[model samples]
Target: MFRILFYRPEIPPNTGNTIRLAANTGSQLHLVEPLGFAFEDKHLRRAGLDYHDLAYVRVHPDLDSAWHALLPANVYAFSSHADRCYTDVAYQPGDVLFFGPESAGLPEEIQRLPEITDRLRVPMMPGSRSINLANTTAIALYEAWRQRGFAAGG
Candidate 1:
């Protein structure tokens, strides 16, 4: 399954929802710390209900650490500024799908990092706020999973 990378995420509810998404989809949830919320699973459970139990979440010390842990995988960073639409990409198992904090998207310097092989965006109506973090992750993950025929499970 593909991996979900939350880069310095700050919102609890967003991570909460993504926890459910990851758990249900058989994707690994990689959180690059320092996170803004606790990892007690209570907050996530509060928001995600019993689905939190299904989550396969891993916390990283930092971006470099995450990269070291998951090397050679194509990383698709989600950014509104990107030119490519997400659905256009051909996702592979172990590909890293990275998203930045809700308050601030990935830093421009980070966006230019060589580790990022591609950047993509979900189509949205002009002047509309970016989609919720969890929803965006869900949309991207499902699209990638759909392309793979959802093969990790029966």
Candidate 2:
């Protein structure tokens, strides 16, 4: 499945939801360090998740480490500033669907990166705020899966 990378996420519940998503979708969850919440088991339990749910979750020291480990797959950075719609990308399996923190979004440098294949957005009315992090990830992942006929356990 496509990898989900949270670039220095701040909220606990968002991360918690994504952990469950990765487990169910067969996607790998990557978290960049300087996270807002502790990776304590209680946090997972409080969010209706169990220790087993984190089997697909991996924490990286920083973006560079994540990039090195993830091998810099075709990255689709989700941003409100993007001109391309998320659905336009021809997502392949193992494509990295990268999302920034809930509040700040991705850094300015990411937008211009040579390796980032595309920048995308879920269309909303002008001047509206962004979608929930988990929801965005879900939409992107399903779209990718849909492109591949929803292959499971591949």
Candidate 3:
């Protein structure tokens, strides 16, 4: 399964939607702190519906801890500033699709990490700010899954 990493995400519904996505896609969701809302936030619960129990969700206290748990795998950082398009790469099952907080994209330091296999972006019209967090996650995850032949999908 693919691993979806959210770095310091600041929105509840977005994370909640990601939980639902993860459950449906057989992917793992990794959240790095400090989170804007509590795990028990009503907005989150409502957005995720009943899939919370079905999803593989792990919360790390910090980025370092997240890296400790997810290392030894290829990581692709999603950033608006990146030069490459997300679909250009052949994604593998164990690949990590890394995203940043909705308020701000991945930090420059994080994007420059040696662990990042590449930096990618979804195509957008010029002058557009950015795509919604949950939407972008879905786009990237589906593309990667499609590249892998949608194995294990029912």
Candidate 4:
């Protein structure tokens, strides 16, 4: 399984959709503090449907706490500014796929952290600002899972 980290996410539905994705894919969802919405937000509940109970979600106090819990594993930071493509990596189980808030992506400082194995980007057409958080996540996760032959997906 992979671990998906959301840093200071601002949208409830986005996180909710991710919860559903995590549940279906057997991935763990880690959220950093200062979230824009509460866990009980109705929009989130609606977006996630009934998958919340099926998903493994953990909320960390901050990025340091997340690192403490998730280190000892490869960390790939997803950023639009990255030179490398997401598909370039040979993802392994337990790899951490890190993402940032919807409005603003990962902070430059965080992206440059020594802990990151690499910074990856999903290719897009010219003038495209960004992809939706949940969409980007699904793209990366599915690709990783596909590379593994969709193990355990049956």
Using lDDT as the measure, which candidate wins?
Answer: 4
Across 67-132, the per-residue lDDT of candidate 1 in tens digits comes to: 998779999999988899999999988999999999888888887899999999999999876888
List candidate 2 stretches off by more than 4 Å.
41-43
Deviating ranges (above 4 Å) for candidate 3:
none
Task: Report the error of model 3 at residue 88, Å.
Answer: 0.4
lDDT of every predicted structure (CA atoms):
0.88, 0.83, 0.94, 0.95
TM-score of each: 0.94, 0.92, 0.98, 0.98
The residue pairs found clashing in candidate 4 are: none
- The global Cα lDDT (0 to 1) of model 1 is 0.88
Give candidates' CA RMSD values in order.
1.6, 1.7, 1.1, 1.1
Candidate 2 is scored at a TM of 0.92
Model 4 TM-score is 0.98
Give the CA lDDT, 0 to 100, for residue 126 in model 3. 98
lDDT of 3 by residue, 32-62 (tens): 9999999999999999999999999999999
Worst 10 residues of 1 by lDDT: 40-49
lDDT of 2: 0.83
lDDT of 2 by residue, 1-154 (tens): 7899899998888888888778777888899999988887466546637634544888998888898988757989999889999899888888998999998898879767876888999888887888898888888888888888889831
lDDT at residue 22 of model 4 (Cα atoms): 95
| Residue pairs of candidate 2 with colliding backbone atoms | none
- C-alpha lDDT (0 to 100) for residue 63 of candidate 2: 83
> What would the per-residue lDDT of candidate 4 be over residues 44-84, giving only the tens digit for each residue?
99999999999999999999999999998999999999999
Error of 2 at 154 (Å): 7.3
